[model samples]
Target: MANDTGKTTIDLGNLKAGGFIKERGKDLFTVRLRVPGGRMTVPRLKKIADVAEKFGGEFVHLSVRQSIELININFKDFDAVVAELGEGEQKVASCGARVRVPTACGGCEYNPNGLVDTQRSALEVDEKLFGTPTGHHKFKVGFAGCPFDCPKSATNDVGFQGAIWPELNKDECISCGLCAKSCAEGAITLGADGKPEFHPDACIYCGDCVKVCPTEAWKAAKKGYTVRIGGKWGRHPLVGTLFATFLPEDRVVDFITEVLAWYKEKADGAGRIRIGDIIIKEGTESLLDRLRAGFPDFVVAETIPPQAIATQVGK
Candidate 1:
């Protein structure tokens, strides 16, 4: 129903229950539980299975936001289910105009290609931003361990990708060429002198060269987060624009808070409003100016579209 400002209000009880309103069921609801970073301990897993078997219809559905949903829970069993989940210390995930559970790929924890601790970042974001109010629409955040963007961070409201800029030491180079071979972006190539040459503009800073360098010729010059803002996926998907890079992990929380504050300040509506729209309407440079003003340490990426062709040479 609409509230005082004509904004639609979601039910507080349903939100707390992580309840999904069912259209065709004996009970009106199904519950969703948050599992940040999409990873859970064995004990918690077992507890969830047992709880589902006891109260739900013994079926669990996994959500895109890294949450687990127990279906076929009757209204009468709601209290019991909530108590069981509480006892297990599992938080319920809500779906509305708030920060949802963050999603992340397996970062440096185990993935060979990982450049940063994505799981740890996810947990940190969850602790700091989960369920925080957004002014007009829902906000989603995702973290990718590297440029692979496995978690589809490109399509989230706030996307953080792990990166490392590598520096080469010509003296230490054995010139094995492994770094060139490992680089998928063609950012690194062995020159005639048998030393690796780097193309900074083409490099996504995935850190492959650093990992593959046998002589430690390619060293990590800068390791940090690349921020992408104003992206979302749905009927009309808009890929987020790259906002900043080389953002130290320690400063990510502050960056996110400022971005959210800016969004809330600019967005005004009862219906869904996205940061991408704000960027488009006000010009990306406007947002960039504010970001630069607030966080002077960050290096914002310059986005320039390809120049137009003079003529269609081939049809």
Candidate 2:
């Protein structure tokens, strides 16, 4: 039924899904623009500024998920705003219970600490999976170039952090101890024989040793992403647990597809349950079993419980 304003409830819901968020004002909305991987050209950014000045408020809101929200837009100007944005090849971001735009940090292209091409990965995921229906709730994905985790990968539903497992070639070792000196995790230490001793348990896989080894003695044994599943931040935050190590970059999309399949099946008939909650209810082993069928090599055999933060306020 149409409200007194002559718009049905469905109209507002559809607008929300299309990135036109209703504001407290009677007819004002916020128009969110899709900027995948948080990267945009100067010309495109200039276009957004022009659009904001013409159709929106004095300021635009930069969303935490790396989208740009043009504020104080009138519902009547939605079409005009979208058209103007399209002139610059920009598009609207999605909201509601769907896969939102992927967020990422500067990857190996520019960032010195980056171990993988996170920007490329984020763009790929955005192109293939952005705005997919999650059925139960919103799904988030993040890509961190390295363990520095500028994008806070562990706070998303599906998170990927670049990793590198290093190996020492004793034949090339100059015994200069640079590898041990560069290891922040202390995973590498010089033994009595002046050779580097590796403690795998202590390694966070940042590749510092490999980079610092002047003689190329330390090298990457494996380089890929460390996948974490079912993480989220909200009223009740859960830090995602490690699901796979050294997951090949080429297989990320397929891996996510399988994860979504499992989520859809398990979350069926369960109202508004996040992936982490399903894991908590059905147990991590259940999901592991499903993943192992397709990804026996990358999937870890064991996983730790997602850390739950106590967020009860005034209880």
Candidate 3:
């Protein structure tokens, strides 16, 4: 192909296998379709697959963010293709800047944490931060079912994980150390007079020890989650810093919504960088400052883990 000046066109045909990506509009730019939490009902998938076969390639590509990227779109036909997606009540937005996909647990069977249903919270987060903004770079968040880390929460721009408060029954403990055996992290141990000793630091907050206790000694702890931020898992993975544990389960959506708004205000255009990058350039203090600005009243600090080792012994 030649331009008006008769210059040869730059062909990226080699980059694609099936063939050069098809072009729809006057010019070429990649189009990213957001799918919150990597979820799509069967009907939703069917419609998108049809688009892929018609406008794009035969199938859409899955993304790490749980989003779908449909390439080779022409601006002219983009609207029609999107409309055909047929995701009832499904909303559309730019997947850049403040605009990005929201993520959540894809339904975990053993979620001991406070989080019950994540779909609603995921929607709220998207509504709050799904567009381009002056502040920091692209931010990413992960929602987890439990401490097992299905989506790798600790490495996101913001992370929310389920937690349980403890309910101890002194009368039932037989000093058998069954809880000690149950604790994979050795967070529990037998105390004097058949009671149990708790060492929160030793506890990873996993609740394994509590679950295995025969007498129902350790019931589900008060429900809640830990909010972590400024982390990334890439070439240089950074473990996010914990902002708070035990945020009321119901208010988490609002809390995160506020956090995104605050993040935007803090960076202005400069903050529009990734969480890991921001942490390096301005330091956690600056990020925290922006977070604090959003909610001056809320205190965000890491909560201590559980105390006591598992009961590996018997009465």
Each prediction's whole-model lDDT (CA): 0.80, 0.89, 0.61
Q: How big is the positional error of residue 307 in model 3, measured in Å on the Cα after superposition?
A: 26
Model 3 C-alpha lDDT per residue in residues 191-210, reported as the tens digit of each score: 76667777787765666666
Kindly report the root-mean-square deviation of model 1 from the true structure over all alpha carbons: 6.4
Off by over 4 Å in 3: 1-30, 87-93, 109-116, 132-134, 174-176, 192-195, 233-237, 269-272, 275-315
lDDT of 2 by residue, 83-175 (tens): 778834888889888888999998999888999999999989988998889899988899998898999999888999999999988999999
Best by lDDT: 2
TM-score of each: 0.88, 0.93, 0.73
TM-score of 2: 0.93
**Separate clash counts for every candidate:** 0, 0, 50
Assess the local accuracy of residue 111 in candidate 2 as a C-alpha lDDT between 0 and 100.
85
Q: Once model 2 is optimally superposed onto the true structure by TM-score, how far is the C-alpha of residue 177 displaced, in angstroms? A: 1.1
**What 10-residue stretch in candidate 3 is worst by lDDT?**
12-21
